[model samples]
Target: MILLQLLFSFLQVGLLSIGGGYAALPIIQNQVVDLNHWLTAREFGDIVTISQMTPGPIAINAATFVGTKIAGVPGAIVSTLGTVLPSFVIVLFLAWFYYKYRQLKSIKAVLKGLRPAVTALIAASGVSMIIACFWPDGAVSLNNLNIESFILFAGAFIVLRKFKAGPIKVMIACGLVALIISYI
Candidate 1:
């Protein structure tokens, strides 16, 4: 039953989250945190951080991690498949039609329109995740806040905004700062 739920939830996210892995974060968070009670919002955010630090898509990483937490190795396999299947199906179909309709103006126009819709979905997903982070239970309060996280978030934002350093450099600097802060 748990495996089935994991598969269905991930599959739904995989189907709808068209932009990229970050675009899927809110759906995963909603299912894992609010619907299933599989993990807390902080844990979900931790998963996102770890997913970003690691290789592969965030959605797949999340599926494996969350599934394992819920129902072990089999759950991971099922969840991972669920997350990938939609993309596989959609891409396969698109590839088939794209070669034949490559010059069709109507198809081209539809594709152009799709780009903005996908972007909007991605943006909406980001807003939802931000809301989840700040207001887990629909009420915003500083008491529920994680101070270290907010500090790190602020510092990272400032660094990224002011210095214009490459992302890798910023990640490295943040990692070192986190290590130093951990000991203090």
Candidate 2:
């Protein structure tokens, strides 16, 4: 029953999330943070950051980590499989459909409409993560805001976007600076 619950929870995440791993953050948050209470908001934020720093896709990493946290190895396997299964099936189906009807006007229209929605989901996930990082208790806790973290975030954003720095370099630089700050 626990395994079934885990699988069903992540299955919904896989089926509902449209854009990709990052876009699935909100759905995962709703389930893991808001509903099931498997992880705290701060923990969820940390999970996301750790997932980003790691090699694999964020959603799968999140599913595996959360499942492991909940019920050890078997939970991790079930959750990861649940999170990936719908996407795997959908991709296979879409591959066939796209190959067969690559120029269909209806399909083209649907794809075009999906672009903005996916962007919105990704942006919303980013904003929520930022909020979670800034205010661990809740987004309403303005007094707990960390100015230095915001400065670091702004610096990273500028370096990545304006200067067109590579993400790996930016992350390394940020981590080094954070380490230095800890010593000071």
Best by lDDT: 2
TM-scores for all candidates? 0.58, 0.58
Q: Which residue pairs clash in candidate 2?
A: none
Clashes of 1: 0
Q: Per-residue alpha-carbon lDDT of model 2 for 1-184, expressed as tens digits?
A: 8888899999999998897766789999998899999999999999998997788988889889989999999999999999999999989997999888868899889889989999997899999888876666674566789776777889999989999999999988988998899999
Q: Residue by residue across 1-184, what tens digits does model 1's lDDT show? A: 9889999989987998877866788888887899988999889989999986699998899899989998999999999999999999989998999988978999989889889999998899877776675565676677876566567667877988998878888878878987999999
Give the whole-model CA lDDT for all candidates, comma-separated. 0.85, 0.89
Return the clash pairs for model 1, or none.
none
lDDT value, residue 18 of candidate 2: 91
Clash totals, every prediction: 0, 0
Model 1 misplacement above 4 A: 103-184
